[model samples]
Target chain A: MATILVADDFHENRDVLCRMLRLVGHSTISAANGQEALDMAQEHRPDLILMDLSMPIVDGWKATAILKTTSDLRHIPIIAVTGHVTPDEINRAISAGCADYLAKPVDFERLLGKVASLLGDTQRPPFLSS
Target chain B: MKLSIRTKLLAALGLDLALMLILGSFALNQMSAMNEEATFVAAQTIPSIDTVNTINDILLSYRNLQVEYIINVASADKLRIEGEMHHLEEDMAKAFITYDHFQLDENERATFEQTRAGWEQFVTATHTQFIPSNRDSNTGNVHPSFSRLAPLYDNLLSHVRQIKQQSQQRATTALGRVRAAYDASRLVILSETTLTIVVSAVIGLTLSSNIARRIRKLRDATMAIAGGDLNQTVALRGSDELQLLANNFNLMVASLRQQHLLLAQRNTELSESLETQRKLMSDLVQRKQAEEAADRARATAEAASQAKSMFLATMSHELRTPLNAILGYVQLLHLEAQIRGNTDMLPDLERIRSAGKHLLTIISNILDFSKIEQGKMNLEIDTFEISSVANEVIGIFSPLAHSRGIDLTLICPPEIGLMRSDAGKVRQVLFNLLSNAVKFTERGHITLTISHEYHSGKAWIFFSVADTGIGINPEQMGRLFQAFSQVHHNTFHHYGGTGLGLALSRQLCQMLGGDITVESETGKGSVFSVCLPADIGTVQATRQTHVLHTNGNLPRHIPGSVPSLTPGEETAVVASPTSMTQRDA
Candidate 1:
């Protein structure tokens, strides 16, 4: 299992996404905002990050751009997560150094699949296969 | 002369009359002189000549009687001769007295005096000599004393002849004077008549030609005015009628020229005003056009502002409240419930999940309807099998239909091959119709029929949902597909729906180059059909034009609280397929 970061402004959304990642056999650390997410990433150096684009401070797009520019944290894959699902928003996310994009009311299965694929695991995670 | 035509004409006539009068008076004077000469020749000259001739004839008769006495032989003859000789002497004295009664000139009087003297001598000689001779004659045959009487008788006869010749000469001279006077008067009259004619002709010619020349000048001036030359003036020098006419014509021409100047000035002013009016008209037209353009720009800006507010409203109120935390927590709870093997709670969790999804669907409907209204919806065309879509739709409705105790069937031919269209919208339309069918029908069967066919060299796919349900009345059919309009308002509480499914479905079908139609019989069943082009790309080109035309006619503002769907709803829409898959799993 890999260490993952989940950032969201809503506590319930963060709690549910963290739970879903743990259920899928991945260990996840959570942040309530993009600034907290950056601090958590710098502290733990998580293998992956689930970035929520709309946040109170240091929005996901700025956080991703900052992390990608930093030498030490630039190698970590980031999957931008947000409620905004327009094509323009998705393109913006991808172009802002995000490894992938996911619209909210997040499908856990697709989220797990994208997480595993970015981590170089081809098979579906054990919780999803079960 | 400063004469009028009437005065000049009268003067010319008067001159002719005076000349004629002068000729008449002169002719009268000459005639009176001629008449006096003729009277002298007729009365005085002829009477004197006749009386002198009468005296000369008596002397000749006395000589003849004396010769008769000398030749007589009887005494009775001698006595008769003596009585005749005595009567002859008495008659000679009476002739002398008659000669003294005539008027005579100086030469005539001298000639008459000699004749009278000669007459008295003859009378004495006749008494003395002739009587003695007659008495001395004894024998009636011969008288020796008759010789003395012969010379005396001859001398008296010669004197009487001279007096008669002198009187005849005076009569000839008087006649000659009358003839010469007549010739002189005739010459005077003839010359006067000729002079009158020549002078009259000269005067008439001068007057008429002068009048005619002046009239011609006036006529030419009038013609010049008529020809548009206002500078003409008729100049005349006399005070005649023609000159007066010329002066009046000059006045008239001057008046015409003044009026012409006034009219020309008025025309220039009118034209200037017309030009100003035309410029004002053009300015007004341009201002009107500019105002219209400004109005159009304001309308566009207002539309954009309305769209932005609608998005914000939907995000703040409709989307963020229930969709973000509630649906996410519910899904987490559903997963947890299933993981914990809480069989009793699983149903309630599923109910909550379904209700959350239903709310999501309603929000999606509003968003889609707004996008369509704003001409923002675009087709995501793909090639997919109709059978699979039909099967999927049927599977979705089958459980609901079974729970409602209604038969659900799919009539899709195997030959219904791959169709090209917006698969998501197509599936959504089919889902909307099937869900409606399941919600409305109590017990009767519902059938979904899918077919593809060639229509005039173009491929078309038709999806029809026939439901035995509470059929709609004819009057409600008109507004059936209108957004937010529900036909069965009385049963709205009993049958819950947002009334946007049919409207959204019809709009989605049209965006895919298709249409939706419904046929129903009251209290029996309803059949809703959707027809779409197999290859939506071909019609998408034309559909864009249709969308723009609709956009032009759209109202400036769309009313209602379900204003627009925000990005939150878009996420729900994007997550829908996965949600369905998970629900099926």
Candidate 2:
């Protein structure tokens, strides 16, 4: 299972997204804000990061920028998750170092497909061992 | 006349009175002298001369008469001699009394008396003989005694003549003395009259000169006042009414100066107050304008916020509808693949794939709209044939329009040349309009017309898409060009659209110094017109004259690739052959 980090400000949305990832047979870690996500990303170095753009305290854009610059976190693919998904917003996320984008309320299948595509059944990191 | 004025008036009165007195006294003295001279002339000299002349005439006449009487008595008879002698005696006595009273000088009087005595002696001799002649003449007889006495009478007459000569000499001396006295008295009277006249004339001249001098001073002061010299004073020097007038004039000038000063001060104060009031009023107006400007800014911000909220709601609806299709199709594909032992549902899978693809396109349009709103879209300008672009857009809608029993037509001018513009953006705008026309029209033909017109040394190209379909209402037409606005509330129910196409088209047109306009009526049709500058080559007649090429023979195809079928198609295809084997087992 690939390790995935899901960051969202709303608890219900975060829980639903994490549940979907788990159903897809991926090891899931969750954070409530971009700052918590960044901390988790530095510590666990998840295979892929799912970022919510409209979070409080260091939004997805700034967090993604920080992660893109960091040597350790740069390898992880960050996918932007937002309810307000427009082509311009997606382009903005892509420019901000997100590998791809998914809009909410997310289609569980599309979310799963994007995760599968970015991770590609990659090896799990040692720290993510269950 | 009080204080200064009284002093001046008193002085003026004193001076005038003194002048009057001097003139009057001089005149009076002169008149008195004249009266005294006249009296002296009339009472003393004239009376004395008359008396002296009268006495001289009387004595001389008497002496002559006495001589005549003596001659007559001596030469006549005794009776004639007695009558002449009596007449001579009476004449002599009358002359003696006149001489006594008329002679003023003592020597003249004595001469007059001696003349009278000679007359008396001759009379006495003649009287003695006169009686007898008178008696004889009465008896009517002439006496011979009178004739015989003629020689004696001649002798007596000669004696009487001598006496008469002596009296006439004394009388001439008396007349000469009287004439000398009259001439001396006239000389004295004439000298006094001249003195009085000269004195009166000098006094009148002095009085008139003083009055004239005072009047001239008053006239000068009045002229100075008329000349606008209010400070001038009439300082007349005299003890007369003119001096009092000058004092009053000075007081009037002082009052005028005070009033002028007060008026000037009041005017300055009024002007300053007016200036302050004007400044205050202007400041109030400026403050009011500032407040109005702030109010306008607030209203603008509120309007912007409301528009943003409207955009958000529309976006939510637009995103939700497409997402439902995409998610629903994916779920169906996954579930159906699991149900069949061998799954290959190509048609259902293709529908899912196309739906997903359409959702992607819609999302992309949303992103583009956001970029345009954020002012991030950049145009890439290049030169391309404008007819080709129009042909491509026409090709895109032709299939869809045909499927709906609507004819799609494109008319391009014969030899349109290259146009310099952002080809991609222009193509997008054209595609959006054409596709919208095709989607909205259920029947009836849609035609896109293009033409070029030359105006003011420049070539302008007009492009219009005209459609005969269900059209927009007049009220909703205004809102059609606004971002994310639909024609009616149920517009989404009838036709699915993002509604940003016409707004973006207008924005693009405006960027190129052109604009898009629309004309529409409910159930009649719609026409959208776009005007833009043509390229230089298109403006040249030589290039336009070349044989025009048409796309009549060109094969048309979809510009972008289509996505493949979903996984449901693979399962359905595999499951078909396995149906008999499963039953046999």
Candidate 3:
């Protein structure tokens, strides 16, 4: 299982994201905001960070930019989570050092598939949606 | 006379000549009368006076010679008596000739005739009765006859004296008459000459003042006007050229007054025009500035419009994020509930999921349209397995078909292999079609078919989704792809949706160089097809070469004559017609 950090401002949203990741056989951690997410990310050094870009206290873009600048946290892959799925918003997330983009509310299957691929884990089940 | 100017002048000159002719004629007549008087004195009166004086002298001498003969008859006296006798006869004859020579009046002729008779009787007695009868010494007879001879001499002398007196008196009276006539003629000629002179002077002065002076005044008036004094008037009078000239000058003055008024008005107009021109100049400047400001305002408006369009295209994300999370977790919970076999709550959970998903799709369609407007929606063109895309889309409607007790079928051509086109867009459009087919059809069947097409040197992959259920009416088909429009308003109630799926699907298909067409009728089956032009770059070039190879004929991969795909490079997903998603035609 891959270690995943779930960052979101809404308590219910964070809880749901962590539970989904756990059900998908991923090790989960939770943060209330970008600051907590950034602190947790440095401490845990997770395999992937699910960053909610609209959070308070150093939003996803700033936190991502800071994490990319920090050598210790730079190798930790980030997947920008946003309600804004426009190309410019996606490009903004990627340009700020996110490894990929996921528009919210995230598709469970699509989210898991992207997370499995980015973690480079061979043990995850293939998405058999069709 | 009421004469013209020229006639007046000529008449004055003619008057002078006429005065001269009258004076000349009058003077000539008076002088001729004086000449006649002078000729009468020189030719008749003076000669008659001289003849009378000679008669008196001859009568005295003849009477004295008779007295000497009466005194003594001496031989010398007798001889003197005979000679005196002859001389007395000669003197009497001379007096008669003098009377005849004068053109005498009746008184002078009567006096001459009495004188002539008296002389003839005295001469007869002196020569015959008183003198010797025969040549003897007549002394004796002389004394006796002395009385008779004396009486005869006295009578002869008296007649001669009477004739001389009458002639002298006639001559004096004639001379007095000539002197009176000469004085009267001289008085008349001198007065006529004075009258002529006075009349000529008066006429000359009148003409000079009336004609010449008045004309001069008219000339002066004309010159005054020529010298630019229009107010000057001519001093001319009478019914002549001068008066007419004065009248004309007055008319000219009136015309000049009218002209002066007109000139004043024109000057005022010119001043007003200058004012108007000045106003126009300022107006033009203001207009030009206003135009420039308008141009600047237009430019600013255009820039603001562009900014607004950009902002509106990429609208806010607040409405979607939370909603997305809600739908996402709901789907997860449903999946969890389904796995746990909580069959009793399945329907309720499914309802929540369906509603949430519908709302999310509506939001997503709006966002997708905005992205399209901003030109941010572009297909990723690539080679993709055409049947696999069709199979994947048909698989989405399979569960719906089973739930509704309808057959779901896929008829994919074996040769519908890897086509160079946007696979994701083709799947998206195919998903929309399959979803609509499954949603509309209540009972019979939903069929998905794929065809490989080559036409006009282009390749196409067409996927048709046909459904046998409550079909769309012809009128409803018209606005099938209009955003936010639902064919047959009741479709919205019967089939729950945001009504943006077909429009968004059509837009997505068009973006991928394809179009979706629908065929339907009321109470019959409907067939919806998605036709996409496959990546024509390499295909077109190969087809052109093939056409050339075939000598300008069609390339081989036609619809009825489709070719099979080559093996090994791709996995074709042409399922069996009777697979789990299949239904008989």
Candidate 4:
């Protein structure tokens, strides 16, 4: 089990994403915006980040860029999530250092699958096993 | 007075002719006078002079004959000499008679009278004394008589010679008079001819120079005009033909000047008009350029509007973030409740989930409507059984139909097979129609009938939802598919919906190469029918329309062989009103 950071401008979205990550036996931390996500990521150096692209400040793409460029945090994978699901946005997010991309409302099963693939964990999450 | 050329010439000629006539008549009079004088000299003076000379010769011959008679001694000689003397005396007498008949001047007549008396004396003495004395041949009386005869003869001869001299002098005077007359006539003729010649020459010179000078002026003016000098004009002095010509030439020059001025004015006007046309052409070019610039501005504004529309539509989808959280939490809560075996909280969670999903559905409907508005909706085509889709839509509406005490039925033909279309959109259209039926109905049945048929040589699949519920009013039918148009404003609270479902459904149908139509009767029932091409790809290919990929994504089609649908145990009814209720209870 690896530690993951969930970033979103909406607290509920952050909370749910963290709760889902926790339920899958992964340790999760949450940030209310892109700026907090960046600060928290630098401080915690989590194994993965689920970054919400549209946020109050610094946005997911900027935070991802900052984290990916940093020597210590560059190894961490990022999964970009946003309600803006156009192909252009998906491409933009991936080009901004995201390991993968998902469109909101986030499908938990798909998210977990992408998370697992990006982390390279062979183990299935608890919710999917059930 | 006007001395016309004709009159001038005629007057000059007349003057010349009169002068010539005067000269001719004067010369003729002088010649006649001279001729008369010469005739007088020839006819009277010459003859008188000749007669006197003949008489003198006869007197001398008489003297000689008397001497001969006195000297001859022979009788024969005396007789012959006597006969000659006698003949001479008779000839003398006849000559004297002839001389008496001749004309003579007074001096000649006096002298002739003396000579005639002397000759008479001689003849008397000869006959009375000298002859008798001569007959007695040696008589002294004969000597005395002869001496007297000699003296008389000498005196007669002297008188005769005097007469001859007088006659000769008269003839000389006559001849001198003829010669003087001839000289006087020659002088008169020469002077008259010279005077006539001078007058005629003066008249001819005056008339010709006058006419020639005027004609020269006119010719000069004409030459000036021919050389393109329109300012030239002629003024002549005389009231002659040439002067009239000069006046006419002046008038012609004035007319030519007027024409020249008119031509210059026309040239100026033409140049001005040409300049004006050039200015107008430039103005047109400027106007056209301005119009093109305006067109380019309009195009830029349209592009900006499209971009803004895209952003807004994407933002609307983003608006569902909170709703997603609510649904997610509700599901988590329900899971928690099930784990705790708390059945009572499950219903509230389910209700919350339902409310959140409905909110999401409204937003999604708005998003879809906006996508249509932005011309950005894309079609995902796949082959799926039409009856199965109909049954699934019926299953979704069964609970609501059961709760409302309305029978929901799916009437689909078993042979209504697989269709290549946008299945998701078709499901959404059926859901909207069935939901509307369940929401509006009080007690009647909601039937969804699925069928497949050929239309215009192309396969079509139709989903018709007919409900025996509250019917739509005819007045509101025209606005039925208009976005945001709720036909029953008063029933808006009674029937809760976003009202965009039907509009979006119709748009979606149209996008799929089909259309949605409705029929209804007031206070009875309503029917909504959706007709779609069985193969959307074929329809798209045939029509070659701008139907998909507004966000620049290619239309996604499932890669698989089509599975045909048949009536078998594999086909199961998804829901019926009774079964749906029984399963729920």
Alpha-carbon shift of residue B583 in model 4 (angstroms): 28
lDDT of 3 by residue, A35-77 (tens): 9988998899998999989889889999999999998889988
Which has the higher TM-score value, candidate number 1 or candidate number 3? 1
Q: For model 3, how does the per-residue alpha-carbon lDDT over B1-585 read when each residue is reduced to its tens digit?
A: 356677777887798788778878877886787688788888888888788888887778777777766665577767877787687778758777866888988877887887777877877776676666434554455466657667766766777677778777876876787788778878877888788789878977877766767778778887888898878877565667668778888888878977987999999999999999989988998998999899899778656644643554445366666676687678677767767877787788788878777676666766765565445675566887877777777777788789878778888768767888667767777777777766666667677877766655667677677777656666776667766666655667767665667776767655555566666555666666666676734332221111011011112223432223332211222222221211111
Binned by DockQ into CAPRI classes (incorrect, acceptable, medium, high), candidate 4 is: acceptable
In Å, residue B195's CA in model 2 sits off its true spot by 7.5
**How should the candidates be ordered by lDDT, best one leading?**
1, 4, 3, 2
lDDT of 1 by residue, B149-231 (tens): 66666766777777788887888888998999999999999999999999999999999998888888888888888898899
Q: Which interface RMSD values do the candidates have, in the order shown?
A: 3.3, 6.0, 1.8, 1.5
Residues B285-377, model 2: lDDT tens digits: 998899899889867865664465447445764565445445545554554464553356755676676566555546556555544454445
Q: What share of the true interface contacts does each candidate keep?
A: 0.39, 0.00, 0.61, 0.53
Winning model by DockQ: 4
Off by over 4 Å in 2: A1-32, A39-47, A79-96, A99-130, B1-424, B447-463, B472-504, B519-524, B532-585
RMSD of 2: 19.2
Of all native A–B interface contacts, model 1 reproduces a fraction of: 0.39
Tens digits of per-residue lDDT for model 4, B154-243: 788788878877777777887787788778878877887888789888878877787788788888888888999898988787687777
Tell me how large the interface RMSD of candidate 4 is. 1.5
Clashing pairs in 4: none
Name the runs in model 1 displaced over 4 angstroms: A122-130, B1-305, B312-322, B537-585
Report the Cα lDDT for residue B1, model 4.
36
